[model samples]
Structures are given as structure tokens and as C-alpha cells.
Target: MTDQAHSLSLPRWKEPSILPGFGVGVGLTLTYLGLIVVLPLAALAIRPWELGLSGVWHELAAPRVTAALKLSFGLSALAALLNAPLGLLIAWTLVRYQFPGRRILDALVDLPFALPTAVAGIALSAIYAPNGPLGSIAAKVGIKTAYSPLGIFIALVFIGLPFVVRSLQPVMQDLDAEVEEAAQTLGATTLQRVIRVVLPALAPALISGVSLAFARAVGEYGSVVFIAGNLPMKTEIAPLLIVIKLEQYDYAGAAAVGLAMVAISFTALVAINAVQTWFAGRGRA
Candidate 1:
């Protein structure tokens, strides 16, 4: 009995299972992760230190680098925030209501995922250029659409939308209409029903979608470059700056910029995850 209790108290390295090769599976998983994820990240972390701490700081604090980082992270976050509600609405509509051309609309959501980034960038630039239809209309209003920060925002939103939609679709499908009906029967208004009944359950998936969209937008290069005009201290982005550094054969400088991005991105993701956890706990309570 004591031995059994002691065994139960001890941590199990792996769960008990009828399936064989648990040890082999664990070994393979670790090996794959180390090779693909850990080693590369470790190398990146190590490379930037070739620049001493002050050198890394100087690289990050340069005016062009500062502006680029701000533009990349700021627009990425704003795009993700905007995508949340729009994607949720689209997901809810696709799941709850059948309409003419519903299948076509559903298929279009995945178009960005399928399209090459360079092609998408070119398309966006053309459509938003000064002489293009939308650009002409914007120019009439004294707004520059292409070759500006707004253009960067547009490109980020385009690439990030699918992440939000795909993440929420499965969760939306599993959400029951009956609970909403119950809330309505208990004197909840449509808005109240949505706020009180629907949102809590959807929160985790929504946050995950936003996180993915933000991360994707931050690292985005191909789609944004054409639209952004690559103006230093204006429309330029961190990833683009990294490329310029590499082209100049400034490996340490590139690594410094890359390291700064990683740190900021990781911090933002951690905060998002913390919010997700809080929402999850609140829902359970």
C-alpha cells in the first residue's frame, strides 16, 4: 500500500497507455523540436550577442530601426484587434445561416492563405495606387492609400484575416443555439445574450486567433513591401530593415534587430495568453 501510494505520488514522465513505443515517441518528439525550433532560436539568441550589449542597444535605438519596429508592431496589433470582430461575424454567419453563394464566400476566406505573398503585395499596390479606382477616390479626399502607413495596415489585415476566421470557425460551429434561446427566454435582449452567453465561450478562440494574426503580421515581408513604399522612418518595417542589414553584410546588426523583435513579440504573446487564461478561468467560475 505504501509502495503504491509512493508510486502514485511520484511524477509520471509519461501517461500510462496501452499503445507501445511511448519512450520512442517521446525521444522522437524532443529530437524534432530541438532540431527544428530550439537550435535555431538558440543560434539567433547567441548571434546578436556578438554585438556587445551596448552595440545591440545602439542598433535597436537607431531612428530608422525604431520607426520600423513601431510601424510593424503597432499596425499588426491594430489589424488583429480589428480582425477579431469581423472574423467572428463572418464565422458566425457562415455557421448559423445559409445564403446564396455561401460556399463561394467561405472559399474566398482561404484565398490569402493560398496566394503567394508577392502576388498579393503587387495586387494590393496596384489597386491602391494613385491612379487606381480606390486610390483615385482616396486622393480626391486628400488621403494617400498606397505608399503610406494605411497601405501597410491594409496588407497586414489582408494576410491576417484568415487566421482569425479559421481559428474561430470550429469553435463557432460547436456553440449551441439552445443556450442563446434559453437566455432570450429568461429576458435577455439580443445584445445581452451575445455579451453574457456567447462571448465567454468564444473568448479563448478569439484571443488565439488574434495572437496568430498579430504574429503573422509582425513578421510579414512580401505582402507589405510593395504597398509600404519602404520609406525609412515612415512605412518601413522591422523585417524589411532586417533584410537591409543582411544585404549590407551586417550580420550582427541584423541579429540585433531580430533579437529585439523576438523579445517584443514574445512579451506581447505572453500578455495575450495571460488574458486568454483569465477569460477561461472567469468562464469556468
Candidate 2:
């Protein structure tokens, strides 16, 4: 009895599984994550260490670098903010209301994920170009959507939309409509039901989707460039600036900028995760 208890309490190197090759599965998981994710980030941090504090600071503080970083982080947040509510609405509609071509609409939500970034960029540029239909309308309003900061914002929103939609879909699907009916039966108005019940239930998933979208938008490159016009200190984004540094043979500078990117992304993710945690706890409470 003592020996059996000890064996049961031992750490699992390979978890008991119904599936075959648990050891190989674990090995492949670790190997893929280490190579594709951990190794690159580790190098990103280590490479810039050769540049001491002052050297890294100098690279990061360059006017163009600062501007690019500002634009990249700011626009990403804005795009993510725009996506959250819109995604929620779409997810709610898809799950709640049966409409014509519902399956097609559901499939289209993942279009950004499936589309190549460069191709998406070109297509967006064409749609918002001066001669394009929407561009003509915007031009009349003294607003330029392409070849400007607005264009970058648009591209980020386009690419980040899918993240928000997909993250909330599973959660929305699992939500019970009977709960809403219960609320209504208890003298809850439509607004009250949504605010007091639906919103709280959806809060955790909403935060998750928004955070994922923001992180993705921050790292976006190919889709933003064609639309941004790559104007230094004007419309350039940080990832593009990093590429410019590499092209200029300023490897240390590139790494420094990359380091800043990593730090910013890490900080945002942490803060968002904290918010998610709070919301999750609140929902439970």
C-alpha cells in the first residue's frame, strides 16, 4: 500500500494516456516549442547584451526608433480596442441568430489568418488608394486612409480582427441562452441582462481576445508597410524600423530595438493577463 501510494504521487515524465506514444508526444511538444519559440526569444535577449546599457539606450533613443515604437504600440492598442466590441457583436450574432449564409460568414472570420500578410497589404492598399471607391470618399472628407498612419491603423485592425473573433467563439458557443431567459423572467430589462449578466460572463474571453489581437498587431510588418509609406518619424512602424537597422548593418541597434519590442509586448501581455485574472475572479465571486 505504501509503495503504490508513493508511485501514484511521483511526478509524471509521461502522463498516463489513452493515446499511444505519450513520450514521443511530450518530446515533440517540447522540441517544437523550444526551437520555434523559446530559442528565438533567448537569442533576441542575449544578442543585445554586447551593447551595454548606454549602447542599447542610444539605439533605442534614436528619433526614428522612438517614433516607430510609439506608432507601433499605439496603433496596435487602438486597433485591438476597435476589434473587441466588433468581434463580440459578430460572435454574438453568429451564435445567437440564425441567418442566411451563416456558415460562410463564420468561415470568413478567419480570412485574415489564412491570407498572406503581403497580399493582404497590397489588396488593402488598392482598396484605399486615391482612385479606389472608398479612397475617393475619404479624400473628399480630407482623410487619407492609405499611405498614412490611418492606413497602418486600418491594416492592423484588419489583421487583428480574427484573433478577437476566434478567441470568443468557443466561449460564446458554450454560454447558456437559458440564463438570459432566467434574467428576463426575474424582471431584468434587455440592457440589464446584457450589462449585469452577459457582459460579466463574456468579460474574461473579451480580455483574452483583445490581448491576443494587441500582441499580434504590435508584431505586424508586411501588412503595414505598403499602406504606411514607410516614412521615418512620420508613418514608419517599429518592426519596419528594425528591418531598416538590419539593412543599414546596425545589428546592435536592430537587436536593441528588438529588445524594446519584446519588453513592450511582455509588459502589455502581463498587464492584460492581470486584468483577465481579476475579471475571472470577479466573475467567480
Candidate 3:
């Protein structure tokens, strides 16, 4: 058989590589990630090792540090959980519906990205303080929001909401509506269609959004400080504790607390990603 004839017999889907860009792209990607991500993380891990095991444990187990850890991790989880459903609805609305001021509403979701954390903190505090309009209304109802744990939760929510919305927006946009229609044709109820078809497809993106929100909230500082009142052992977040330690020239202590938060966030993120991947595999199957 001739070479040309042999080639013609091959399937159209089989194409020989005629370009050499793959190696260059892969090498560049690895080098960039190594420099920007792996190196800094390695430094963070190594710095705390300079302190002995006893020193590290004591630093991390200090009352203030422990409280800060709880505040940061606990509040971040709560904020992400709160954002998940609302963000899903927002994403669905943006993708599935058309209304007046739709563009403005879409733009508003990204406001937190452009707005400074300090400005957001101040704005929230002003609006929610006892003397402010909203605060006065809340005060009449015996609820205090600003300068409290609630304030921290609100700040975290403000910043984290966008992550989930933006992450799911594209996924929802690309979702196959035909599948839902087919399911409905088979007599599946709306809830069953969502649970059996839509939710499975959106799971990866939703999990990604949740993880991003949690990570962002965990390390947040400026937005939380003003509203949380920086109260020790009560409303102080882990990032704020790190700042306090830095202010007092306690580098070792600051590093310890920062390292602990980093570790926890990293582990949680890993778990979320694993779940996402598992769901994606099942979806593909």
C-alpha cells in the first residue's frame, strides 16, 4: 500500500501532530506555577519550622490564637454556606431570565471585587451602627449587627457572595436544557429534574465557588477589622490576630497563627476539590 492511500484509510478523527507548541506551553506553565504558587507556599511551611515543636504548639494553642482560629474558620464556613444558595439563584436568574436593569444587576455582583475591603467595612459599619438608619430599625427589634460577631459574618458574606455567583454563572449558562426537557417528558417533577439532572451537572462549579468563598473569607482582614471591632478573644479573626502579633513584633506568633489558618484552608480546599472531581466523574459516567 502507498503512504497516501494508507493515510486516506485512517479515520478523520485521527490527526497527526504537525505543530511543536505543546512542549513550550507545558514548560512555561510549570515554571510559572512553581514560581508564583509552590515557592511561596513552601516558604510559609518552612518559616514555622524554625521554631521547635513545643514553641509551635504553644504559639498556635495560645488562647487568643485559638479564638482567632475558631472565629476565622467558623465564620468563613457560615458565610460560604449562606452565599451558596443565594449565589445559585443569582446565577440562575442572570442566565435564565431577562428583565430591566439586568446589566446593572450583573455588574453589581462584581462590586466587591472592585471595592476596597476597608471601604466596604466602613460602609457596612456606618449603615449598621446603632445611630445609622438600618441600625436604628434593627435596634428597635433588639438586634445589634455592627461591631459584633454578626458584623463579621456580614462582611465575610459581602466579599464571598461574588465568588460563588461568578463561578456558577458560566456553568449554568452552558448547562444543557434539553436534558431537563427529556427528564420532564419522562414525567420527572421539577424537583426530581433538578436533583437528578441539573444539580449533578452544576456540582463541580458549585463546589469550586464554595471553596473559593471559604478561602477568601478565611484570610480576609480589612473588611472584618472595622466591623468586628477587633475585640480580643471574642470577635477577632485569625488574620486580625496575625496583624496584632505583627504590630507587637511577635513574628513567630504571627507566623504560627498564619500557618495554622493556611493549613486548615488548604486541607478544606483539597477535600472540596476531591468531592468535585468525584461528582464530575460520576456525571461523565
Give the best candidate by TM-score: 1
In angstroms, give how far residue 126 of model 1 lies from its true place. 0.8
Estimated TM-score for each candidate = 0.96, 0.92, 0.90
Checking candidate 3 for backbone clashes, the offending pairs are: none
Residue ranges of candidate 2 with Cα displaced over 4 Å: 1-28
Residue 193 error for model 2, in Å?
Answer: 0.7
Rank by lDDT (best first)? 1, 2, 3
Compared with the true structure, model 1 gives a TM-score of 0.96
Q: Which pairs in model 2 have colliding backbones?
A: none
For residue 102, model 2's alpha carbon misses the true position, in angstroms, by 1.6
- Cα lDDT over the full model 3: 0.90
**RMSD per prediction, one decimal?**
1.5, 2.2, 4.0
lDDT, candidate 2, 21-86, per-residue tens: 877887999999999999998998988778898888887888988999999999999999999999
lDDT of 1 by residue, 182-250 (tens): 999999999999999999999999999999999999999999999999999999999999999999999
lDDT of 1: 0.94
Q: Summing lDDT over every window of 10 consecutive residues in candidate 2, give the lowest-scoring window.
A: 9-18
Task: Compute the lDDT for candidate 2.
Answer: 0.91
lDDT scores of the candidates, listed in order: 0.94, 0.91, 0.90
Q: What is the lDDT of residue 114 in candidate 2?
A: 92
